[model samples]
Target: MIVKRPVSKSLARAFFCIVLLSLLSTGVALLTLASSLRDAEAVNIAGSLRMQSYRLGYDLQANDPQLALHRQQYGRTLDSPVFQQLHHRWVPMQVQESYALLHDRWRQMDACLARGDIIWYRQNIASYVAQIDSFVLALQHYAERKMLLVVAICLLGFGAILLLVFFTLRRINQQVVAPLSALVEASRRIEQGRFDHPPLETRLTNELGLLGRTFTRMSGELEKLYRSLEESVAEKTLSLQEANRMLEVLFHCSQALNVGTIDRRCFRHILQLVREHEPVSSVEMAVGATWRLQEGEALADAPWQTLPITMQETRFGELRWQGETADKPSPQLMQSVANMLGRGLYFNQAQKHTQQLLLMEERATIARELHDSLAQVLSYLRIQLTLLRRAVPEENRAAQGIIGDFTRALNDAYQQLRELLTTFRLTLQQADFPAALEEMIEPLRAQTAATIQLDCRLSLLALDAQQQVHLLQIIREAVLNAIKHADAQEISVSCVSAPEGHHAVYIHDDGCGIESVNEPEGHYGLTIMRERAERLGGALTISRQRNGGTLVSVSFTTLSGEQTAGRPDNNNDDND
Candidate 1:
């Protein structure tokens, strides 16, 4: 197989032609193997036998009514003559023993079933099924292994032929060809500008070795440049990885905004993510007017670099990252992190402001509706009641009492209607908790002669829109109840941090203390307050104030996002 001929044009051509023909023959064998593999899908005898055995067992276990049906299904497979002929026809010598035993077992089981020998039938049938299952599994395993081994042998044989041809060419180059030939080959490889060559010492050590040494020296210099190139590639790869990490951080921040998660430490979390990748001593992100995210040691004492962050022509903030090197972490890197935080914060603020405007607009609309429809009707009823009161007899006690009752009921209805209009008339002007609280309690002062005072120290808790809405509602309900039910001189609202970081809101009034807080017909307001409190994921407590008034408070912890009471499912009735 070592076909290393000297420099002869005709002989070299002849040798190459012969080798090409041999490779083509090998390719033909591989194609034949592929065809055989495709045909192997039709080899389903063992699998068929396995299914038949299961069918026979199922027939034996059938109920009285189903016995005939199961028997018919079973007869189509193993019980029929076709399966028997198939089982005996191939008769391979290697599996002759297993085939003969299976054939005999099938006949015996058939005979037992026919004669109604229950005990022997059960015993022999179980044995027959087990043997067939084992044999089928064995056949399947053999087939898989045989196919894999055949493919592996063919591939390995082809590889060996290629390896043989390669060595034959190497032998021809080294032994038959001299140093001049080596020089010629080396020059050609050099012309291609590929420096990956075998050792020069292994080749002829004459002028060829000197030429190889020269080429090796040139490649070694080129190797220094290659090493420098590899280092540059590694640096670029690291930058790419850092960039991807920053992208993921930005993606997570975007999610926080989408979920309406109002986090005061939003920028801090983002900076911490940056510090994870960059070699920075500290990071400070000055975002907007009041929110500044500072992490690591305060960089006040040390001189730090700054990168201004801007979005949509509005310069919102700047990022300052202090590190060991002056130019290691680029300004672009610092600004990228800052821009994400700034833009995200800006987006969140814009969304919140837009929502507030929409809410106010909708509230105004609803207030107009209540005034136009229900308020008009209440006014007409009140005027009629006044006329009726004037016409009543001045001295008749029973008539006067009835008239008074009617007047009081009409007044209560009008008051409730007016209160509904007032509730939908106003809106939350600001997103802050304290500002919202102050705005909510403003109307209760005008509605009642009672002095309303708000005492809030709720800085620790950050609540989203839904929680704020629910809290405001609960406070409103409490205040209304105090004014209507509890005739109080002074009403004080307290919002302070509770134990375990929970926030408690308390509204107290020096008014009539209820002996009963049950859900009576007239006490619908208390029920509404309780429901709003539940929406805040907290309990509403109504107890006697220390000075003979009412104290209503709601206590809740931090939340993930805005949450509300789910509407009852009308579609569930259809399912039922």
Candidate 2:
């Protein structure tokens, strides 16, 4: 069982009281001693006077015969002279009378002794001596009484001082030492983590009680703070753990998406992964102008049109999704899905076009056979007709006219076949991106009379062939839209490396600001630009410049040197 201690304030107050009481007691003792000393001095002075009076009477008796006789004669008349003066001034009235009689008797004896009267001298001398002895006895008694009184007072003062000291010590122990000891114990308990115990309660309504109350309040506050701090730390630790788990999940998802080839299957897998980790309702793929999901069969509540999908100039499809609930997806999750879809589309387009190329190659071979054999035979027939026209020439005007018309018809047939062959050869091929961009802008410059400048700062060798192609396509569409729709006087196309370690293409057109158009049309040009950028794992942004112009920008990561070979196919006919 441990006991709490009292506060320091109580001890300090008790000590102050002790010191005050001690000073008061000491002052009182000194005053009592001084008064006693004064009384003793007065008593001593009285005793000395009585002794002096006795000595004077004796001297007068033993003096010369003549003077002694004169003293005897006047003794009866002492009231009239020196004896009267001495009696009146030096002693009390009662003692003065007694001394006067003694003096008279002494004078009578002295006068007899001087006249040879020894008998008278003896009798008077004995009587006077007795009276003087009695007087001296009275004085001695008075002095002894005064001395006894002073001694009694001194003893009383000593006893009082001792009692005060004892009481003071007891008070100090009760108010200060005892309480302080208890306070020390309480502090020890507090140090040992026993905050449940309260401090000792001092009942004195002074500083001691105040200190006790203050200590109690402080202890309570400390306990509350400790508990609150512990709870806060626990909550923060749990929050950190949850955040770490979320980060781990995000890391796993990133790794899975970054590896492997991108395709429709991969795209679906990514959606599934997102749904498993997060919360997604449905996903849809749109290729060209066609929605992969048929009408009334979308996974989400709204129709496919409600999704953010653009149809016209879209090079490849988009995968638009929403959360199962009304909540929007996290921006981080959305960006991740966008990147995965871009890479997936790139691979899908390459595979689709590779298959298309095979079919086109077969068709081209058949067309070449037809042109080489059947067309050659037809050519020979036309040549034979030409020769026949020359042979019948001289005077057969109708025959000559017939041969010329036949030759003209055969030449027209040959021209048509050549045109068909040329169209087939040019069907799937594309020109170099920069050259293609230059070509598209030439016509824009001619039509708008705009000064269009192209700044191609990007190193073509640094970009993968596929990225280069998409970048150029995005730029061409952006420039065309700005020049035609924006109605600009000047257009600037710039391609450079983005500060964020990506390639960027920017198109600025001096035109009416974007705010001027209350509602911009969903032109295929913008859609195509977005699709091309997305397909290359890039982003496209459009904004009205502070000045009167429209600005279009695209940014995409550049592939490393080793990964640049075998460019991804862009044979996506899905222009929607």
Candidate 3:
């Protein structure tokens, strides 16, 4: 059978006991066997001596030279190895005493026989035989005692082995087998997703104890991972729900924006939906005084977060809200709110611009009709009146005076009609300020035959359509006045950036200087140009240049155009 390593210290004790008892039993059994063998040999030698002594005595009793042969045979037997063993004194104590007595008797008998005393020889022979018989009994007794000792030792060794095995098996059951069974059961429970294992506390220095500790550590880690996995699942579920809600917002808000259904109520509904997802003290949106949506009470400068309401490249206005800071879901809602607000404002303004376009289209049609029909008739009447006044004789002063009055009235009516046509005209085809400036300067460049240089330096200039129209008209009138009144060539229309972050447009020409730069009689065009500049949130100045040219300059500030606000699209920081 194979023996496993000792489970603990107790097993070691059992093993050591078995080994010690085995060695002791082996030694004692061997000693008993040696004693028995020695006793048997000693007994055999004593018996042989007794037989040889008897033969020697009988030979001595015989007469003639044949008796010498008997004596030689007795001496030869005594010298033999079996009989010679009794001659030694180092035998067992009992055998040694018996042999000593027998030898004394035999020696006396031999002396008597040599002197031919038959009476003493016969007496010594019997005594030697008695000593030899007593030695045999003593050896027999010693062998029996050794045999008993051997049997006792064998029984003891067997008992010891049985006891050691029993104790070791019992201890193995308690320490190793039982612990391993408990661990196996715990593993089964763990496989079934039950983490509550039995406590495995031990102070033993054995393999089982170490395995128990390691298993305990493993169970703990598994429990942690299980809990963490559950938490992760819950987190992902929340994320999906949030994604779904945002999709819903995108769907509904797109409908509100796509159709021309955007208004204050729709914007407020969007803000309310966003507030349902997050917190907001107030959300205020303004689409250039046309539409405004405000919900909840607003606090002033209390860490307000600003967002842009924009669609593509067009911006409506800024949306501002103030509230407590929010988490992942809240920021996403903020972005949706921004997108909804931007689209709502964008579509609403688009509708307003559409209506304005229709109204302007109607006005253009009326102006074209007047210019094409009424204006022609007026021109023809004025010419006919001129010819008719010439046909009237100068001698009739009254008729001449009447013709002059009629001509002057017709001329006044024509001038008013022409001014009306200019007033009703709107040139808003271009969107950018720089492009509009170029378009306005193109015609003047062709008419004046002047090398008109447009030195615009700013990359971006933010101005609403109305501001651009008024600003363009001012530039146009100023350039026309410069050409007509100044008779200038080599004009430079320089639009440079001014201090305090203002944009200045300067028109300079080397032309004939005017007597007065201010409003003069019949200088109504200058007055209208100055008014147009004022409407652009700027002032105009007309002055004669030092190098003999007129300078008409207008400086103005751009509207709301700055960096991008918080990129709520990604739900970044509110202040971003």
Candidate 4:
């Protein structure tokens, strides 16, 4: 089955014939098409002759001053290079004869026009136009004939190539492929230490046939030789296969564990890989009481071997395996895998903790920056507005009202800046979302006499740190709005999951409802809330409840990239 020659001479000759035939036909067809490119030009020129003949006839009757120019144009049209090609010998006899007749008639018509014989010119114009029409038709027919010739040449060439390919393939299949396939089959059986396979094709007179006969004779000798060492070969082969399997398992386990961080999913993946590659009927990994991943049959009473997934004194998880096979994975290999898992988990926690610290540091820096710059400016503005209000006359009620509005707006801006600074500082306090939410609400609760309740059912939702931050900010915004605007006694902040895996945070207050959800000119509370919701791939809604009070809800699915729908009352009333 080992072919030394790159290709057979016969195949080379066949390919050469195919390529040569293809090139010849393509060249001829291209030449024909190129020549026909001018056929359209000839037809267009001949067609123009009819229109010129009619114009000239009209000029003779009208005695137009442009008659001389029209006559010269007509002559040029008839003698154009495209029409001159009609005189070539290769042009059909019908086309050539038509052009000649049209030319002679045009000359006579020119004589009549030159002599000012209006009557004779009028009579001959019809016959002259008829000849031009005949010439145009003839040119069209010639172009079509060339197109048909090109098509015929292409079809013949394609058919010749197809037949050549079919013949070559059939010969290769019969003479080369068949004999080689039989020889390969015989060699395969001999490699497997099997000799009672089908016989090889040795009747043909070729190198392949010689190989087939040689294979048949060699297989007989090998059968005798293989019979002597078959048992020992099987034993060695099995042992090698087992060793290779174990090595492969260890290699893949290392690769799977090589990540910047590991999660529960990664732990489950490692367990699954162990079950697939090792000769184990079942595998389980337990990392504390929360994350337990198992693969294969679960037999509680079976004798399970345990490997501690530990690094030094710290233990991250446990790996257990159970199987009835005598070829169980070695204890050393299992322990190595367990150690890798432990290191992966340790690194995962360390990386997360480090990232959280970095995030907190960044938040604290931003808070300090805002407090020094924007917060100081807002405080100055509030003091200036108070001074302006004091300077306003108490007698001018209109001036007093305007100053009052300015004072309220300035105070609102200052409050919002302080709240923002608080938000940034609060996030640095706790990395856990629930703890952060509690801290964020504690200060707000102190500002109002309202009873604030926190119901967080976030056990089913897995939120990353960024998502947690955005969600907490949105809740804080809604809760602040309730406390400042909604004059209520009870405010409920609930974070719950829906049956469809959607998580929502609802801040409801039993107070007077908001007239409009739109923030006033200098306010951006609702706008900031919406932006934060969008960052979480969610939507924010601020609507009035049926009885009274405002309900602000933000809903989003666990799966990212989806925009949650929000239905808020489209009240356009201005906030006074």
Name the best candidate (by lDDT). 4
Candidate 1 structure lDDT: 0.64
Q: Write the per-residue lDDT of candidate 1 for residues 67-88, one digit (tens) a residue.
A: 4464455445443442343344
lDDT of 4 at 260: 53
Q: What C-alpha lDDT do the candidate models reach, one value each?
A: 0.64, 0.57, 0.68, 0.76
Root-mean-square deviation (CA) per prediction: 43.6, 18.9, 13.7, 43.3
Model 3 lDDT tens row, 156-183: 8888888878887887887788888888
| Ten residues in sequence with the least summed lDDT for candidate 3 | 567-576
The reply for model 2, stretches above 4 Å from the true place, is 1-202, 262-576
- Structure candidate 1, residue pairs in collision: none
The better-scoring model by TM-score among 2 and 3 is 3
In angstroms, how far off is 31's CA in candidate 3?
10
Model 4 misplaced regions, further than 4 Å: 1-257, 261-272, 278-353, 389-404, 428-461, 483-502, 508-516, 543-551, 558-576
Backbone clashes (count) for model 1: 0
Clash pairs, model 3 backbone: none
RMSD of 2: 18.9
Is 1 or 2 the stronger prediction by lDDT?
Answer: 1
Q: Write the per-residue lDDT of candidate 4 for residues 233-269, one digit (tens) a residue.
A: 8888987886787678778877776765455456667
Better candidate by TM-score, 1 or 2: 1
Residue 353 of model 4 has an lDDT of 47
Using TM-score as the measure, the top candidate is 3
